[model samples]
Target chain A: MPTRILKKSWFIKSIFFTSAFIILLIGGITYRNIDDLSKSSELLTQTYRLNVELEQIFSHLKDAETGQRGFLITNDPLYLEPYDAGRENINYSFAELKELSRNNPTLQKNLKDLNVLIDERMDYFQKAFRFSAVGNYNDQNFKENFYKGKKLMDTIRLKIKGMIKSQNDLLKKTQHTYESNLKVTPIFLYMVLLFSLVLMFFAYNKIIRDLKEIKASNEQLEIFKESANQSQIISQHGNWIWDIDTNTFKYSDNLYRLLGEEPQSFESTVENFMKFVHPEDAEKLSREIEKMITNKDLPFVYYRIIQKNGTIRHFKGYGKLHESSDGGKKLLGTITDITDEIDNLRILEDRNLELERNNRELSAFNYVASHDLQEPLRKIQTFLSRLEDKESSKLSEVGLTYIDRIKNASTRMRLLIDDLLQFSRTNRADNVFEVSDINELLESAKQDLAEIISEEDAIINSDKFPKINVIPFQIQQLFLNLISNSLKYKSKDRIPEIHITYSKIKASDDPEILKPKKPYYHKIIFTDNGIGFDNEYAEKIFVLFNRLHNKDEYSGTGIGLSICKKIIENHQGFIFANGKPLVGATFTVYLPIT
Target chain B: MQEDYINIILADDDEDDRLFFTDAFDELRITTNVKTFNDGVYLMDYLNNEESIFPNVLFLDLNMPRKSGLECLKEIKQTDKFKDMAIAIYSTSASEEDIEKTFVMGANIYIKKPNDFKTLKKVLSEVVTINWQYHTNGLNKDNFLLRL
Candidate 1:
């Protein structure tokens, strides 16, 4: 389907067609009027000729009568001569009238009667002249002849008058028709002219409208081109097309701007384009381009380019191979100056490396503090023990008390350091995730605290555990810390009974509990009948070095729960603790079942 | 002449640790003779000497100045002469990497050096009393790391 241009040709075509039709119509009307006028003129000329012939005939008959009357009264030869000339004139008029009315039956009949009358009248005239020449003063037959002549003249006058009246009527009818035809032709012509003018007006209006529309469209196209160029400049993008048949390339002005060159400054050949690429990337780019053109397979290419200003920039170019309408290959593509993006990525990578280094240094510090720091503290305690064992009797009471205090403080320091080590180890541990049997992890955790379990007479009731993908060692440590915490903080009135139960919960079922949103999680709850703190300290207990009870009340460095929290997090899971002052505490761990 | 008595050796760079270790053994009243080396090199030299008797239990400290306990453990396990010697990594560091490495290197046992003298005594007694043949025959990573 062809696209519809803003300027419509159909309007112009319609106008042309209407103009032609109107001109043809006007020509036809003029032609028709001229034809009708000519026909009416012919009819008028025939009527006029017939009327002239009738008038001549009537005049001649009157002259013959007058001449006959004179010749009879005085018996004169001049009168007789007038009668002879009238007779010849009447005969010529009658022949001309007959010839004029030959094609008309009615006119021919009238002329025949008029001719008989004329002949009779001439005979009467002759008789009168002869009778008078015989010298008869008065004759009865002559009077009768004069009476006949008078009557014949009257009859001839009436027939001539009738013919002239009929001719006059025909002329009047033809003239009326010619006048009406002239008036009607002009009115019809004016109507046709008015229609043509209207058609011309409509055609002209449509043509002007189409021209205006075309102008507006051209203006819009100019604005569109400017905006496209502006957008390309802003986005650091430029488009190009490579025509294989012509072996020529068309580059948008922005492409030249991207290369730090004036438009049309550089020749657009493959080798010339490669010259702009960074030396290290040029060969690979050349090979890739060669492969793309040979195989007609275009893939995205990202490389470094050296601009005309000697600045290195990263460019990402991608195009598609297409067959032009003329069976020639063409590649149309866009190139983006991705230097800023590359810089950002490099900065991110550098920051990541720095962060990893910081992490390594921090773990190193933890290991050193855990191990090396213990050496001196252990020495102090050991030598103190030796001093106490070897010289207890010599020491005073205050000295012994001071020594015990020092030992106690050092022991607490050792425990704190050990807990700190455990806390840091969660992050420093191996990151290999495997499918480990939770039952075995729990069993090992139980074995680790077997001595305390038996000594405290703690009853550990646990449900069967499911196997899960996790860092087994970290999970074991997590279990150990929670269980040890329960035993250490057991209620005084009862044997410590810790219930370990776990159930798999879907993310849809327990949205609040599994906050991080995994498909499946093991909600392992460790509910103990041990000394629990206020519920307000539930979140606080998970914080490093956050102790709910006094040191004397709970023998802990307060790092145990924090280590548990870290371990659970390592497995991409969540840990929560709930406690009440006298009631037991429950530590719930959510581990993803993956 | 003294085959019945337990012979224990400790290799440590820290003089106080060596003193404390020997004192702990002395206080325990176990039927044993204890010897101490300042570093791993000295300990290795003493064990290689044909004139010297092989200790029933050898306590190797991981972080010594001359040579690391892991390197010594590797050397001893490779040497046929030290096959009868029961190797124990007694270091203040309880890092899993150290323990695993020492275990893989054929160390008989791993113990984190305790802060209190009583813990040290208890750990040493338990280690010294272990049936070396039986322990070595069934040595596993699980039983290798001995926590005090």
Candidate 2:
């Protein structure tokens, strides 16, 4: 793209150079034409002057001849005066002709020959005049002399006419040459002017085109700068530049606004900007700025600033060195306001501390429930048993009944405590999950209820299970609780038949799994042929201490199913219960197949 | 001392528990000599004496005033004289933590104190009859707790 621009600029430059050269050429041609016209006109003027000198010489010779003829006809001495004056005038004209024809060889030679003919004509006139003074009117010598003078005068006039014709011919030749030059010069100069004008027009068009392009790009740059300023305000950031060579700073207009002042309200210098810095952070910020100047770079620096309205804000800054093509060094920097983030972090830290305290207190409560509360209760039961064994015979029937009632109450209390402890243990954070054999865990659970299984004649069928990742002890307890729940609510007429089935299924296959966190789950379904309740209580059954059956009807602490739910949730799995009155209950547990 | 009868010792802080232990032993038909201490300190003081007779089975109650059953077990297991003696951890609340700790410290078995007098007598007799050499050979975490 830049290369294309460079090529275009080169084209414009060549056009500019071509236009200037054409203009200079026009100026040189016009100057040379003017100089040639002036030289040609000067030659024409010299030729006109030379022709005038030649005509004057001929007129003077005619005057001298006319005077000599009058003297010969009337013997007037006044005529002699005219002849002498004419001779002097002719000599002066001859000198002027010689001076005018000095540079022209052909004209000088013609003038010299004309001078010789004039001199011969004058000699004949003198001879004729001398003969007339001696009164020899009838003498043949005088008559011959006069005739010869006339002939000599004719030759001189002819020579003068020849020189005049030749001089006129030379003048005509000079005029023709000057007229021809004048004729072609206007056309040539007009064509050269027109060509230069065309070159100038092209240069003007290119300049206008380039200026339009520059205007378009400049407008785009202006729009970009405006948007950048708006973005800086929105994002709570500002930009700056520090010229390292001159140690001068340039802050963008938005940078001034970031300091809680109008744009460009203050000079952009370190001292001027430092006035806004929080006193506590000023020293640190100064040290960082100093380092940035020396290193020609700025690492991330955090500081605080108090605005004019007394609102304190946290700022983080970073800079990078920019070296322009002309070898100017500058640091381009950006600073952001991060007060909101720091405040959020502080709130999160406080909340975390409170949560930790609450957790410690909860564990303390668990310890009390496990050890302290059970100690006294165990002693009471032991003493009660002693009473039943040793003093039963002495007591009345009512008193013995009271003893039995007390025993039942204590046993129920112990059951409640033990179940509650089991529930809380499931909530422990440190339970380790391992790859354990599900079959082994199931067998162990059944072994825990071995005597009941035999006495109730419960027929428990199971499917072979693969190794699964789970909390071994907790999963065993889950199996134990579920099986016991079935036995406790067994139908009286038919023996309890518990069917345990296992399969690996996709979470999408189960409609009950809403918003599943995992794709596949280990589905273990425990379907028991027991006295089931209405399906309406399926969800309520898992609630802590929630029971569908009364204590008199079923010996449940209502904590068993709740513990199952908790265990499933700990593994990010799901548990569901479905039941129909007297048909049976199906408890489905889904563990994530990790 | 009679060589044919078994020697048993129990250390518990509760007076009523001590009375129950003696009464159950008195009712049983097994020919045994029983000794009792109120707390671990008195029990340790008597066992540490060189002249005192060591019991074949030592039952240690976990909760006590000066020292606990776990601490006493640690001390007894470290002594060479008590290497062959069977140590049983007997506590009211048989928490998994206590059972695990006592097992690691070389206790032979763990028993939660039974709530009824008959169950207590039954557990004591069963424990007395157990062949320590055979039980120790097959001891594991699963059977470490003496289930009812």
Candidate 3:
């Protein structure tokens, strides 16, 4: 391409050469102008000098001729004084003319001739002065001397004219040469100046064209920079440029705003940026960044940050870091604010939890409706059976016996329904809790079970029970159920005896399904001398409707232990039964110490 | 000669509770004769009598009555003449706050009606055997006499 440009520029080159030639011409013309000025000055000087020399010669000659004529006219020796003075002066002038005529060989020769002529003339004038001094004015001597002087004067005049003509020729030649040179130099200077102007115009146009292209490129870059910044803001993205050599970082305005900062307000350094990150997530972010940096794999980092307002926000930073061969390793990245995305996820999680809670409540409500509703339904069934018996006729004994069984089954179903209702309403009891004396609570509970206590002939004994924080009515129900459970399950051979003992026991600190997560608990024990179930069934004894004895042997709804479990759980504690089958049962309840 | 000890009427709906109360009264052996009724409606029906015996003591169960014990107590207190009758409220609940409110309603004593025979005896002796103010038409200014 460069060769193509060079080849294509031949026309331009011709123009350039033309312009160059013109410039050379102008330079030469300018130099020649100065040369002409010097030459003209020299010419004028020569003319003036020659003129001056000619004037000196002519004046001296005139003085000499006049003096000679005076001497000739006066014929007195005193008049001869002018003649002698003219001779001395003409000699000095003759030498100057010779020196002035050196540049012209012809003038020099003429000057030599004039000098000889003046010498001859001077001699003739002297001879005439001698004649005037010797003869008294005799006609022959006077005529002879006068004629000699005139002839000498005429010859000297001719010589002076010849010298003047020679000098005039030299002056005319010098003037002609100077005028011709003056005419040609101006034309040459004008052509040179025209060419110089053309060359300057071409060079100036080239500079301006290059500058225009450069300016256009700069404008395009400005537009590109502006759009890039706007897009970054809209996308919640920020970019960073680190000058590895300077150990400095520069971040975009979006990064500042993501951390709840104004455009001009935040520091975007990596150190300061780490400060905004959540401490728990910082290590993870850093580790990921480090791994990416070390491996040059350029992995993306998504982590949580705490904004200036103390809200947990999520941020994602993605970019590649490369080693700048220019001398520093720099890491460049883009950050995105993901707070809204994280908040939406949290809301989804909360909604799922709410859904689960609602599902549990709905199922519990259904269980209560089906289990507790049986009592009234069974009563209605029994009444219906009794009414059917009143209308019965022509039935076999077997059929009658089946109807009686149905009535008995309905009666038992009625009792089961009542116990189920009690179980469901346990949490709804409006028992105001206070610092109830456990001693008083136990005594009252024991007294309330009067029929059972007497019928079973259970010898009840007690010890000082620890005061605890509990709902008194609920606890009373708890005691009544447990005491009844013991008496109902009494052994046929063993005497029924119930023992209640209490101490500030440090309960097992482990948390159970319904137990409060506390450090310690108060253990209360109620031991009974009744048929205790096997240890394998100890955990199952607390389930609703879980019974070891048949209804014929021990009359109970089997819901007593379940109620006790609910109350114990409500008190933020737990209860468990421990015993062997046909031996005895020991139920211990743990209550929170606080 | 002693105004034939005041007749105090006791009413309850529960049969076992009534048995427990009667046995307790027998065991305590209080001189004041007590009458019993099945419900507060029956007791109120008797109280409305114009020519009937005015009982000296009335032991009412709160849980009884189609009108409730509070309503009966309100009726008794509103009638100025019967206000002097020593009324005791018997209940299975031992809430102290309930006893406080009953006293504020002009009850003479609040007794926890026991479910156990032994507890009933103790509660009966404590209520019927305790010295109580006997109302007369013109008693002395300092004291209304009570037989301890």
**Reference contacts recovered by each candidate, as fractions?**
0.74, 0.65, 0.00
Q: Over the stretch A65-114, how does candidate 1's per-residue lDDT look in tens digits?
A: 77777877766768767667877887787777767777789889878777
What is the per-residue lDDT of model 2 for residues A1-594, given as tens digits with 9 covering 90 to 100? 333455688777887788788778878877877787787677677767766767777777777777888888888877777688988987887787788777889988887788788888888887887887788878999888877877887787788778778877877787787788779878987887788787778878877887787778778888999999899989888999999889899998877877888988889999998898999999999999999888988999999988899988899999999998679999999999888889999999999999988887887688677667777788889899989888999999999999999998889888888888888778647889899999999999999999999999999999999999999999999999999999999999899999999999998988888888889999999999998889889899999999988798788999999999999898888999999889899999999999
Off by over 4 Å in 2: A1-26, A43-241, A248-290, A302-317, A322-327, A332-343, A391-403, A435-440, A447-469, A493-511, A519-524, B2-7, B29-33, B47-52, B74-85, B129-134
Instruction: Indicate the residue-level lDDT of A327 in model 2.
Output: 93
Query: Looking at candidate 3, what is the lDDT of residue A553?
Result: 80
Two-way lDDT contest, 2 vs 3, winner = 2
Model 1, position A479: C-alpha lDDT score: 85
Q: Evaluate all candidate structures by whole-model CA lDDT and list the values in order.
A: 0.83, 0.87, 0.71
* Arranged by TM-score, best first: 2, 1, 3
DockQ winner, 1 or 2 = 2
Per-candidate interface C-alpha RMSD?
A: 1.4, 1.0, 12.9
Query: TM-score of B chain for each model?
Result: 0.94, 0.97, 0.77
State which candidate has the highest TM-score: 2
State the TM-score for model 1.
0.68
Docking class of 3: incorrect
Worst 10 residues of 1 chain B by lDDT: B112-121
Clashing pairs in 1: none
